[model samples]
Target chain A: MKQSHMAFMESGNFLYTLDRFKEVPVLYKGENIKEALQEKIVSTDSSLSIFPYGPSSGGMVESVYFDILTQGERIQKVSFDAGFKNRSIKLSGLSMGDALLRIERMNGVHSAAYSSMFCHIWEKGIAMDIPDQIKYLRVAMMEAERISSHLFVASRLTGGASQNIAHMNILLLREELLRAIASAFGHRYFFGVNRLGGISRPVNINGFQKKIRQISDEYREIFHTLMDSRVFIDRLDRSAIIKGENSSGPAMRASGIKKDGRNLHRYYEGLEFKTITSDGGDALARFMVRSGEIHESASIIEQALLHSGDLKPDPEVNEGSDSFMAGGFMETPSGDASMIIKVRDGKLESTGFMSPSILNMEAFAGSVSGNTFADFLFGYESLGIWVCEMGDFQ
Target chain B: MKAWILRSFRKGIITSKFPGGRNENASPWSTPPVYRKGDQDPYCPVGAISQGKADANRCISCGLCYPNYEPSMDIHGSVSSVSVPALKKSIRIYQIDVGSCGACNLEIGALANPQYDMARLGISFTNTPRHADALLVSGVLTDNMREPLMRAYEAMAEPRVVFAVGACAISGSLLGKAVSDTLRIDVTVPGCPPDPFTIMDAVQKARGVK
Candidate 1:
């Protein structure tokens, strides 16, 4: 009888072995590697294994499994097994509200972005008019979420270099933002806040604005301190290079892409917002981009708050269609997330989600190909790609 | 480095004095759902509440339960009073994500921050289950993850605690029948994703925090 066992390799590799039989390489991304290096692969029957769950991943979702072949301390070939974590998100036959709830769970932290995209797509299919204040509120919520998400990435990147103090400071800032969100909407993750046509409740700007101001001040001080640290800068500089159009969100902005979905939104037409860009296209660049976006997000929130008082109860409109299909694109903290929905006879027929993680994860393999093991960790933390978000597209 | 030290000194104890001091900052989800006059069926989109009884294991904390109800008025949270005999010395936890959406993981991650500072209570997160006294499992337990979860559990020494950390982990939430029902979970912390304070309280309690 042959039995299969999963094995964990050092750094970037995972293997499955058959008992008392030679290891058969489960080839993936096989064409990406050169023909000359294919002969260097080694097959072994017995190898030390660690369960490929969250423990070894430094608290990341255990959804991703990478298989790497290293040659003399350098990663020669890389492949991944991302199938083990796929959660089939079948939206057919469910009502719009229930569908949105399911989509929210696709990525816990990025729920608002997913819900907004889904609702936007569904509403547009029926061509429902949205109030200007509602758009502003959506943008405000996205910016707030952007701040919290970026802080988490920053904390992880800092923590990767053993800077626990810096990690804790950024996490503390993130907690403060989460508290503000909770105080305003009564939920930390912003679930159920983005309803079709308008927000579920009125905006509470004063308290949220005050918290954003304090967070900005504290963030500036702490970020400046982190920037001045030579060790931290050294670890991040020139690591994980995802140049040109290969990246998105801060990663793309860090690589000098001037594109941002906020510019396309009609509500942001008059708001004072600027897309920040960097030339490094490395880990430090991504980190700096996140730092810059904190300030930008804060400014956007301030502007949005100024107009929040003008929001009126959205006019009641019935958005019913016998057969309709609509698509939407929105800029999340990570990147552009696109959602498409098809409705027939007041029920969902099909839906598609293209989360930013798919594009970012594709770029990840190339970024870490030539880097060392330590740089791989830095690259992953800096990219801020959550495996959980990939279910919608995978 | 010097600046960080000075800043840390100035900040002085930012940690929470929880279960002892005022927990005015408890999360909204920490409170149970209440009945209102206008709330009809589907009070919760995920069906966390039914017939005025809230299932903590199924609630995602979307704040749709009682739209008019204010979470700040009432205070409810974990009792923060469990004393495991075997874990009195200290507890090292290992987290496993069977199939999560990342919220629960973040909540657990937040426990390490200064506010919660779980390390002060003799609880720490280990990178391997072999060194762990508790297996902190999150997300809905899918079939593919069952073997690995069992292997992780088997690796730990006897008298190990398995803590189900979120709604999906506790009752599979929306996944329903997809979640496996094998292991006998020792502790169940509920929420769409439980707050860091709640997570801290659960871990502390599991480690015999008085």
Candidate 2:
């Protein structure tokens, strides 16, 4: 297992120290990697032909370029340029509000994760403990977001299987959750909902939690039906197999690794947080882990909803007249996204974050290498790599 | 086949009453902003507000100026130069992401959901710009994607309109230059990421889809 790779290690921006870097670290330089990482892919095999997909295409949720090295059927390897939408967001010299604003926009699919992680790091840095009520509120928002994200992935898998009926149901569930989140937090993606010490707006957790549980039930029914479809299960069951030991998020958990950030977070212990894992490190296993987590997320939300108390927004963050680094990591909907910031003289001197999407993208590239060309989307979507999250700011 | 049909019909109508009137789906913060009170330069990051008039093109819907220039909850999605009067029947869209936070892409993609059912309005997403009637571009202009974004627009045939969807694409919000600065845009969808309803209505308006 890699403690860290040269990709992020040299930058010195990462919060976690690299005790032992992998001897042969995958020096993933974004767009171009196949040439170095896997020599087998760039072969002179007569049957093999390169096909480029995306960066500008329909059916893709975001802009990403995929270079498929294949023999018209089975793929020898796959290389992707997911950094096309990289805005290179550098949050240095911005106020706390501005930085938080930019953080939420980093990955709109899981804005809650980025913001909550920011807030978590900030609170830890300032040496202030978040109130128990605020903690539950934060946890509830994170879980709801996790449910939506997993639903999106499941929907993608079903869509790949051409299970239009099941796919539609999953999208319906996702939309319902989004609306419910908006109703509770005033914003759809929990933007501005999280503050340093408390949630910005008081949430009606009781109603929100019930709606989540109800959605979870409907989601389970749809997932169950999808599982019943042998074709759907077969398409992903033994496809794109990879060892998840080095992967992050559900990709890691799918391989039966019990290393979920929530498993260690003290706040989640009271909520009966458990790391859900599956046996096979295949797309189906990933799907199983996601499905199980959605239900678990609902249960966590239910427990968190018990303390439905109004929380006042924490006051504006004071700047450090004396500059010092303060940062930490938390389990986002994706994986452990760590953030470190230096505040000096009433200004945020600099900021850096390890957005889990980058690591997961690497995981996707590694897993999809030996699999057939057709298994590309299965392995890709299962890892849930938000391409826009790759460059710069976490 | 008969049982499939029966089961499909059993689900009943989940389609929304969009392209007609405002629905209950749009998030309050993601909607357009309208003026409320006196002159207050409450430091909008996007500079969406100037002289107390809120510009939807630049608004990211951050709600920094609450009470003064608050969320309008408007249904309309964008500000377009002109509608393609001939494209009233069916329109093919090719979406290009120059650089995005993923919200605009999701909101734009949301039009395909059962609730929106954009296909019902003769709208479909095409994989290639050659087959597209319009290009829906999201995110700010990133250096890496500039060429691909331009190439996509170039590949489109005549009567092809370009839509800069979201504050990022239209005005760059806080990221960088608007896609409109580089590419000629016919329509601009506001909000950090405009509500799908707003997008649906705007697309209809852009294509002159009665």
Candidate 3:
């Protein structure tokens, strides 16, 4: 398949270029092709016109460059000459704390995934030998994040339901879940806890298990109450319907596709869990599947905690060989977040990450096509875009 | 539905008495500072404490003190403003930078929330530095944002105060030692991002605002 065009108007800030591929095609105004090419564009103050092309590894633009094909009279293709280069991150030969700090500085899940992809690239080949226990734990955490995120989205969506009680309930429930997660993990968002090797820290099994049980019991009761309420159901039912192909993750799963990372079981083999799927695929169905997944996650966490062992830091694992590429997918709250890594000489040569938000963006664009603008927020909320944005770390 | 409403109403006000009484029961992570001398507390990364005395001016709002600090340390107790030794009595003001990570900014914004209504006290967040007292800043001043930050600081009237709210503002947080000449942050509040109570403590110290 031809590379899909993802055009970004170049801002004259940071552009990454190495001897080869100096000039790239950019669409100018009035359907014209113009190539504004230069070498060594760095620093926000430096005025340089260059195009930064990459699978990943780029910085925010200091200034935007418009394609001036028509003698500056009209505009052409715009490209952001992304500031900073990936090489700036001197990850090699760094202490564990420093490396983790660097990883944290990357900030946001996309950057996390990008750094992970870079790690994969450094490793040169994929490590299929990852412990099943670690894999299961990772999946559980990923699902937990998804569940709360979707719940929050649903809670926020109910603001339009004209019932302040339901909206406040959702918010309160969300806050409760957030506290529970924070209790389990040090950070509310669960950052820096999931390391490249396995997990940075183990869940406080007893405390976390209790919290999870309490939350699950509370949520089950609350959700059951909401579902049984015809008034609430009517507000959510068929309100923001999207087909399976048009939606992502639980939103798509509600429309009936049992594709879950837990099923893949690539990492966590012995972990027993149930995949929540619904056929209605409406706003209500999406909410139900998400709510159900919360239970599933809590179950998985409980299991992981029960089976917990000494969590030791993995020694610096070497990237097997150069010229190797591998991709890892984690089912984020929005959908599947895939990371592709290319390695050369134990260094990240090139990396690309497709955040679930990007996929959900596609899903949202497609789902909202026929719907009126008023229904846009409802449809968007049903798919859980705000939490997706948080996951995007943008 | 009718039954649920009645049950909820019976639950009574879950709203906290934060801005009112000195409620010790804050969030688990919401700890106010307790000044002690030379206590090896691992909560704060930067040495915000000297001889166990927490200089409210030096304290960064990084939640570490509450979570990872000494085991005996009460996170909720640390959520309240630490009384700092006064240099002079002056009305202190605070500023919020929207460009930085929203964590500290959100916590600062939470002051306006019904639960922690900061306006009930004399504290308030102002947009411009002209009407302000102290400046509350967050995030590592990015290379592109240096001018605006400096400009705001310059714009503040004399006898001004500046309190850095997060780790980013203090010690450049995770931005690392690589300092950008153009975008250098002046003050530092530490933590991945500190809680609001930490911020409240800092503001109180700056302006002597009760």
Candidate 4:
């Protein structure tokens, strides 16, 4: 009979492991590694073994048993079983309202990604027909969210400089943007209005378009004011330096990669907008790029609203099929987020999410090496980690 | 430096003049809800507002009653004369808690800010029952809070004003039907958390200060 092992990782930074084995296997060259001494020096056909483990930082050690069919301990067939912490979201037997409420309780970016992931998996994959208009609208909305998040991060970074005026100004602007978002969609941070097949509520074209224009003008004036502040610029410059070659996504593009999802032509084909770039792959460059992207997003929204003429609503799905796998990639405020889904029997089989922060945490660890500890916070803030800090329940 | 200083100065005095002259630039949602006579009242989801009984202590600030109720209610609508059980020259106010989310607390705390300045109007938030004139509480009546809430009300000096800030406090909107507790609140201001101005107006009405 085969045995299993389980490890529990606690939230407050502790790891506990319980391992059980039914058979005591003969080992070669194990005298150096085995710490516990065996009693009676007897070879038994079967024995039970239990081992406890702790965090080693050298990756978890998980192993399983296999019956050896060959000589010299070389097995013909081997089965490996390993288990770690399970932290995936479960969305089952929930109404749309309840589902959205649950998502809102999640981290804000994760909530956005979850919605986008669902749309990507079910709508785009099964329907096989997503209107260019809806795609463009989504891109525009995503860019808006990105700009808002970046501005908030930049504001916090500037707060360390005692530039409370800029900080307050940015917060006010963020609040206004949130109001606009709430007006457009029902909820501010969590747009519970997005549904499968199509939008639950049609965009108030006139009001939303006008608000976008106003926000654009306001952003231009505010960005100019922020740029004028030498203190702000000084603090932002050469901070959180990431080598252009190593960085990817918006961070890289802002650091002069010139690669943009908006330019992918699936949504933004022939869309007239400026692609802003900076040679300096530093905190200020990231800030400037995000600020510039706001104007670009405003332009996209204007175009989308203008082109959205007499559009027909898409058909709704009463039920969905199974055994389908779909993945989606969206450029959020911090960086790119990808969601992979596997659906079976009209329910999600397994879902995986890769957030920019998870990847950027490594980048942050790399960048902060040999730098002063004070720079760590500024560097992290520049990456837009702080925007969702208050929103993190888990 | 000079330009920056000038810019800061030019932004200029955006402070409010409250508790003195008429409040100019009052927040659009500042006015509190008022019960009126000869009008068919809408049933408050939380039962914070009804025909004759307006319990300020039960208000949850959910903003469902003022515009939603019949008789075209405003936040600053006149308090009905017939509804009062007691007649006193000076009205006393108190805030108590049954069960509330933290939004009302923050909004009430906002009174301490430079904009509202409730202290100038002789209104202050007091933690203890002895110092409190009115118990300004927000939330639905939960089982655990019933005894404590009643005790607080009993402890009040007398002629107390209990102002409920949201629909939750008034009739227990979402929490009303399911709540097993027999506790009740008074004078509900409806809104998810009634706007700060609505709270101020409610406070004024409770004290006959307006």
Supply the TM-score of chain A against the true chain A for every candidate structure: 0.86, 0.86, 0.65, 0.69
Give the Cα error of residue A355 in candidate 2, in Å: 2.0
Model 2 DockQ class: acceptable
Q: Pick the winner on TM-score between candidates 1 and 4.
A: 1
DockQ values, each candidate: 0.45, 0.46, 0.12, 0.03
Model 4 segments beyond 4 Å from truth? A1-88, A92-105, A109-114, A244-249, A309-316, A386-394, B1-210
Predictions ranked by TM-score, top down?
2, 1, 3, 4
Which candidate has the top score in lDDT?
Answer: 2
Q: Candidate 1: TM-score?
A: 0.89
lDDT of 1 by residue, A1-394 (tens): 1022222222121222111012113344345553424443433312212112222244454556665545454555455555455566667887776677788888888887778777778777877777667777777888888899989889988988888889888888898889888777667888767776876544455578889978988888989999888999999998878998877788898898888888896657788977998999999999999988998999998888777753433433444545888888888889988877778887888877787877888888777766765777788778888777776431
Worst 10-residue lDDT window, candidate 4 chain A: A54-63
Deviation in Å, model 1, residue A93 alpha carbon: 1.3
Instruction: Flag the better candidate by lDDT, 2 or 4.
Output: 2
Which runs in model 2 stand beyond 4 Å of their true positions? A1-45, A310-322, B1-11, B37-39
- Score chain A of model 1 by TM-score against the reference chain A: 0.86
CAPRI-style class, candidate 1: acceptable
lDDT of each: 0.72, 0.77, 0.49, 0.49
Of 2 and 4, which scores higher on TM-score? Answer: 2
Q: What is the lDDT of candidate 4?
A: 0.49
Per-residue accuracy of model 4 over B145-197 as CA lDDT, tens digit each: 44345456567675555566665555554443212123233345555445455
User: Each candidate's TM vs. the true structure?
Assistant: 0.89, 0.90, 0.61, 0.54
